[model samples]
Target chain A: MADPFLSIQHVRKSFGATTVVQDFNLDVEPGEFVSFLGPSGCGKTTVLRMVAGFEEPSAGKIVVAGKDITRLKPNQRNVGMVFQAYALFPNLTVAQNIAFGLKVAGMPKADTDRRVAEMLDIIKLPQMGDRYPYQLSGGQQQRVALARAIAPKPKLLLLDEPLSALDAKVRVSLREEIRSIQKKLGITTIFVTHDQEEALSISDRIAVMYGGKAEQVGTPFEIYNRPATKFVANFVGTLNVLEGTVTDAASGKVKVSTQEVSLKGKLNGSKSGDTLSLALRPEAISLGRQPGRDSSLSGEISEVHFLGSVIRVRVGIGGNTVSLDTFNSPATPPPAVGEKAEISFSSGDMLVLH
Target chain B: MKSGRFWAWVVFVLGAAYFFIPLIATVEFSMRMRRGAYSFDAYQIVLGDPRFQATFMYSVIAAIFTIILGVLIVVPAAYWIRLRLPQLRPVVEFITLLPLVIPAIVIVFGYIRMYGSNSPLPFLGSDTGTNSLLVIGYATLALPYMYRAVDTGLRTIDVRTLTEAAQILGAGWGTIITRIILPNVLIAVLSGAFLTFAIVIGEFTMASLLNRPAFGPYLQNIGANRAYEPAALAIIAFVITWGCMSLIQILSRFAPRSSNRPN
Candidate 1:
């Protein structure tokens, strides 16, 4: 690939004795929408701030377009940032707030007005130019904030949990709008969010962070379907860990509870009689046997949850409980608790964890 | 609920009457200075007096200087404490409250003793020096109000993020403070400034001790000699105070309201 537009190499940050981020690295292509996905205090925001020049990295270099920006001040970095709280200049009207960067750069009045109008239209709030931030709703204010950040046409755009404060419906709609706007502008953007679904929906690639390090970085499909670590598998979606013992090391066979399943080299290198952890996605398992399903286990129904379209059923096999989801149909009643049921899935669907 | 609201109205009416009755009597007494019928003779006399003009003007000038000095000292101090030295907030707040705890006379006395003619910094040696000392004293008096107001304003807006945003927009420290921060906090600063003006204009203890030609000393002098003019001067002072407070109320309507709250 050509040289990355933004390169973060071996960046680390430590506050006193507590290390917040350690050996973080990422190279983002121009116009790529990359998301740093993690829980709070996992250093996603810290990395974003370092990129924006708010926090200096304790180690390593940040290169943009092949130029080093490690020691530059935030003002000199020419980066744009949209914060979680919608930090709009409260005193200025929406138009003036969007034009703040242009005005500060000493752009001519006619040009500044034109750019402000353009930004207002881009945010889809053209009629709100004269309104103060307080007059607009929370969603509107955040949209204005996005317009303000991008009005300067900075080299890089950073969004730090911008949609975390909005409602559910607004959050979904606004994220779609943000994705469309980013594609239209073709600006290199780094989004930091703790919401897994948000990261999955908007990012071209996601870096799932844990304990101040990127555990896995890949396209959303790769990260979700083929997680590289147990942490990634557990954090990204609903997972069920089934404890089993390797019954035949030579043939990679395992005994899960009362059922014997051929792993077919899924296990890393566990010998016979050794305990192994196998993860199965809830959606990968079905309540009854289906075509092409080679593995099956009998268990008693322990719990049943009616979740509208999908009914989630938990079953107890020997001493372990496994959860699976089945589509709800009015023609058939859901299995009741204390009833015998058999769960089936293809052996290839199981993941052997290290 | 009906009884509770009725009692609330009763308490409000009683409080209003308790406060407004004295003001009504003072106005009535000030207007009855010309003859058996009410007239503006006392107001005319007080307004026409050269002493009134000089002392009132002096106090107004002093109030302006006091406000400027207060802003210079308090805005930066408050901003720095909030941005860099947040751990020192309690210490700074306690120091600002010291003026309130220590009486104005005691502070003025200390100023005289430490800054006497023989001392290295002789603030009481010349008339200009004495005026500077007076303004400093007033600034000290207004510190508590100014700091609290500005601190509250800073609390409402995330100062660190705003500063970072402005910096990323290519604004220097000066622009960040003057254009970004100052405009955001202008309403708070004006609120504090008007309060300071109201406090400094009629201040009696410090001006009397400093031996400055302020309106407070003038009002006292007129009260000692003339009867009707003193009431007229009181009315004028009340009007000025009311004007300052009214301006504050009007300005508050224009203050940048927090958009975080739902409409």
Candidate 2:
């Protein structure tokens, strides 16, 4: 969009005979926060490392701010990166670590000191400039890393699971802080993480990687609700996959268990009697029959989990079990297992997995 | 628990006795130069000798040069091996251990044969060249300790990530090594340096065969010619070695406590 700041075109990386990343491509807009979300060994970090110039792509080019940096060394790339393991110089103080790049760039001492102070302030650790990395807590250390990376005002910022080492509560808070700082600086940033929630909560867009390739790349909302592939849908969020058989090709009618549902134009090219896997989000299904819903499936209440704020129920229809969350209602008890149940949802909410 | 503690104490006392008894005997013998009197006369004589002063100074300078050369060679080699070619580790370790396995005299003879007066290098042709060769030999001898020290130091930190971090932050290889890698592992390097100093200071065979006027040869010569002064020199050498060890302990206290922590 409007002249991408970082463009990775058909990048591929292989270690000898094993290819870790293949034909990877992404164009990150200036100031846009995009996340490479995938499981471990999914090539998310490999692609990020290629962009950061740590790993050279075997094939294809990476351009940053209209300059081809595919062959450039990492130090020559002018890209800041915060590693998962803090990687701050153990011998240097927080201020010195932040000033490391500036000092290397031959910036004057006064200016370097000022920039380090500004960075410390930005990371909300204004008083930690004198402390060594070992003296800081996990969360504080990551914050300092973020500060150190951004201190040089590089063209692009890469965060490699910068919050993974922290505890759950700290992870949430630090992710939010990283997002806010990225926005404030308006530096085009690429964050790599395996956690879908983290990507969805913080990134403007997410590229879901699978099998060393990007399965889908889109805004968080689009990636979650309109996943392009089965991998994307399953990896992004929990999905209920119900096996169905198409009843009519022209009318887009399908049979799920004992119910006939109208899928309309959602099924693009399926013929009659063809088996299909229909997916639905937990939030799309209502516990019982509700008004304005076009589809209803009858099943037995198999399992019920009484969470504090919400109750999760799984209904067994035919061979498949569908899970849905409903708000806790103290006035009415949660449905019991081995009881008859009906789940309803809008027909449009169903996704025909291809 | 009582028996365990008692056994631990017994083991500690035995170890202390095993080490300190020889040193105590040497110190006692060193002071008995003046008959029927316990005086530091032997020490005064050994300290006042100009040959002792020259040889000691020469060896000290040689040790310093050896340390500089060793660090220059070992830190980068260890850093690179750990960062990129980790598979080469066992091979490099084997090469380093060769120094410990092969006798120092054998190495010195190899050096002399390779760089004699008529040889291509002719390192022994001049005093400066001979000193340089001696330092190089000492570096080779110190390789095992130096490499292991830096390698051990490299272990406590994330070498690859730290290198990449510095690289991404616009640091070149030189900057990364000098500013980042070196400082983080300074303690370990110092440990190796002190160990090398002890090894080089008392190293008699290499200095004697190389014909360098080093402290080791000086001690040997004095030990052969005189009795009291030799004991005195032995005690001084022991103090110097322990002083280096003590410095290592003190400097280690100031080393960065942790590098594996997040950030």
Candidate 3:
């Protein structure tokens, strides 16, 4: 590896007494779209700001393109950032906003204009150059902010909950737009958001942060499917941790007994006599299905919710309510309330956590 | 402005009248040049007098200094308090409210005692000293009001987001303060400055104690000596203050809508 495009080496931040980020370390590859996903105050945004040089770490060094930027000022770092509020300069026109960094760096007027036009074209708002940011809608203003940040062709792009402020419909569209633009530019970008869907959809790799630490760092699929910790399992998606014990350990499967049921789940690294607690995702679990010649768990349809495309059915499993989501068009109709439904999921879908 | 709330509207209009009647009376008194004639001759006298000119000039200069200092102190203080030192808020707020607790006379008296003849650090040892001390006093008085304005501005915009964005965009502390933070808080700063100008210009207590040839003392002296001209001067002061405040409102109205935030 020539050098990690951007590397955070065990950075830590504390405000007076409380330590927000502790021993945070990650090496981001070039042209990779990475997201720092976590709940509020999980230090995801704090880490992003540290990378952008807005914050000085209490420990560790931030290296960008082989340069030691641990102590470099934010202005000295060639990073473009989009804020949650968009941070569009109200007094400046869209074009001027896009050209702000170039102008500040003392670029010629013609070149600045050209780069701004290129940015506008890329963000799909070429004609909005003369308009002020206030004249535009929320989505439009964010687009302008995006264009302005990327216009300078920064080495790294930092988006701190850029789409978190938009409405649901707009959030999806803008997030997609941001991903496409990142791909087009191939800028090593760090997107900080608590929205799991947004992170899973856009990021090539995600460092799921918890308690100011990277609980797990992997592809969205890995983080969601093969969660490494209990926190990761609970935080990643709607998970049902059916507390059970390993009654028997076969070749690749372990039969676990819960309070009201006994089911066999694949234990990747578990021995017999060990306590086994596995997570099954709501979407992965199948509901209202025929009993196959496989390990079956007892379930009852306690409640049913009809989402637009899927039916979210909560099943009573071993005195625990496990939500099972199934597609609702032709495959299966949404389960009725108080219906006797048998739920079964593949062993592969079950995540065995130590 | 919902229609069909006529009774509420009536009560609101009455409330507005109740507050504005005294102001109207003052203006009415200023309008009459002679005992019976309604004319702007009072304005002519007020505008024409060199003493009034000097007083207004001093007021403007003092206000400009106070505003600059107040904004300088409050803008970053708001951001720092919000982001870095949140625990220091109550202490800072309490210090800011000191002006409201201590009257202008008492504060100026302290200044005279502390900085007057043969003191440890004589602030009134020279005219320059007196002028600077007066401006500092005014700035301290305006601190609470300016702090509120800046605080409100910070609340409206996402300060953390904006500051980080500016930083990432190659803005140093100086640039961020000048280009980003200051522009965003311009409306609040302007409104505070205008209000401060109005207060300091008409204030009679501090300038009298300090013995500065500023506007407030000039207004007091004029009121005591000249009767008709004093009313005219009062009207002039009212119009100027009103005009400055109105200008602030209009400028804020025309200010770009800062959506720099989520929907």
Candidate 4:
């Protein structure tokens, strides 16, 4: 990254004896939308707050546009933040709320009104300038908050779980709108959220955090398809793990339950008779035998879910149950629960975990 | 259910009579100064008196000053406590309640001893000093109502998030408090202000002891020497206090409805 717009270097945060964030670091390129994805109490919001100057870091520094703003007051740092609760001033009208930053900057009344109207249009709520916050819906309030944050055109934008308050449908739509707005303005942004799908769908790159540290930071494709750690793999998408013992380590032959399969150079450290966890995504496995797959496991169909576009089938082989998704075919009836089944997959798709 | 409704009305009627009968009696007696028929003669006499005008004006000024002082001191204290030092809330509540628990006579006497003419502060040595002391005493008397009103207002909004939001928007502390925090809590502050006004206007113990020519002292003096004028004054005072209460109710309708509720 050449001269990243925002750089957080070795930032650590603690409250008395409890350390929340530890040695966190990330560089966000200009106009790139990055997300800090993690579970609750995982210190994702704390890192974003540190960048917004709400919480000062215990160590290291934050440089935004070549200025070290670690110790500056939040007012001194020209950053815009949208809170999870949609912290719109209740007393002010929508236009006034959007113009709050401009007025604070000593902008003239005419310029403030023009800017407020422009922000209202950008958020697609052009006529809501006269309405108070209480009169707006949850989705509308969040849009107004987004508009308010960007009205002053700050150097960076920080969104702290801005879509978590909305319902499922609204959460999806608003997140897309937020992404589009971020792209249109080409502002460097940091969005903190615990929703994996939300992070994966909207972010250009994601920093998956755990235990107050960045476990993996990569593009969404890399984070989802090639997870760096076990936590990232399980947290990012649905995964199935099969416990298998290596029958022959040189050729990567492993036996799962009653069947034997060749993994072929996939296991580098495992020896014969050693137990290993072989992980696979649900889409990687196919029902019955397939032409291109080199590995096959025979089991009884334990469960079948008839979803609209896809059928989710779970096969039980001894004590291990592997879940896979198969397309819903109109020509063939769904598999029965007690029917004997054989699941096939490519040998290269199985991930050997230590 | 019918019997419950009947009994409820019965209890309400009893409560209404208990309160309104005495008030009706006072109003009736206040109109009897002319004799043989209801008349406004006593009201006319009392309203015309220069002493009444002087003392009432003094108390009104005192109430206004006391309200200003209370808001200046309490708003920042309550805001800071809610935003940064929430753990200290219980202790602050206890201190605010102390003014109510400790009798006014006890407080006035303590003030006299602490700031007498010979004392180092000497707040009672001059008229201006004594007036300041009286306003301070009234503010202490109104502390409980003012603090609770402002605290309740702060509760209805997300103080910490709003503060951070304003700060991040380039608003300094002054702008945040004056433009964001104060405007959001304006109704509650107004509620506290009116309650303070009512309390200060009718306060007697401190003003009487401090030798101030306030309405409360005047009402007491008239009650001791005159009959119908005192009755009229009592009705007027009741009207003023109730008017303040009504204003509080009316102003509350304009308070900004909060959108931030618990998820």
lDDT of 1: 0.91
Error of 2 at B108 (Å): 2.0
The global C-alpha lDDT for each of the candidates, from Candidate 1 onward, is: 0.91, 0.92, 0.82, 0.93
For model 4, residues A1-354, the per-residue Cα lDDT tens digits are 389889999999999999999999999999999999999999999999999998999999999999999999999999999999999999999999999999999999999999999999999999999999988999999999999999999999999999998999999999999999999999999999999999999999999999999999999999988888888988888999889999999987899987899988878878899998888999999988999998899999999999989999999987799999888889999999999999899988877765
What digit string (tens of lDDT, one per residue) describes model 1 on residues A193-287?
99999999999999999999999999999999899998898889889988999999888899988788888878767899999888899988998
lDDT of 1 at B84: 87
Worst 10 residues of 1 chain A by lDDT: A261-270
Candidate 2 local lDDT, A250-287, one digit each (tens): 99999988788999999898999999999999999999
Q: DockQ numbers for every candidate?
A: 0.61, 0.70, 0.44, 0.71
Candidate 2 lDDT over B44-144, as tens digits, reads 99999999999999999999999999999999999999999999999999999998899988999898999999999999999899999999999999999
TM-score of 4: 0.98
For the record, the alpha-carbon RMSD of candidate 3 to the native fold, in angstroms, is 4.7
Off by over 4 Å in 1: A329-333, B1-18, B32-37, B122-126, B261-263
- Candidate 1 backbone collisions, by pair: none
Q: Which tens-of-lDDT digit does each residue in B1-263 have in candidate 4?
A: 99999999999999999999999999999999886999999999999999999999999999999999999999999999999999999999999999989999999999999999999999999999999999999999999999999999999999999999999999988999999999989999999999999998888899999999999899999999998999999999999989998998898888887775422
Better model by TM-score: candidate 1 vs candidate 2: 2
User: Which docking category, incorrect, acceptable, medium or high, applies to candidate 4?
Assistant: medium
- lDDT at residue A64 of model 4 (Cα atoms): 96
On DockQ, the leading prediction is 4
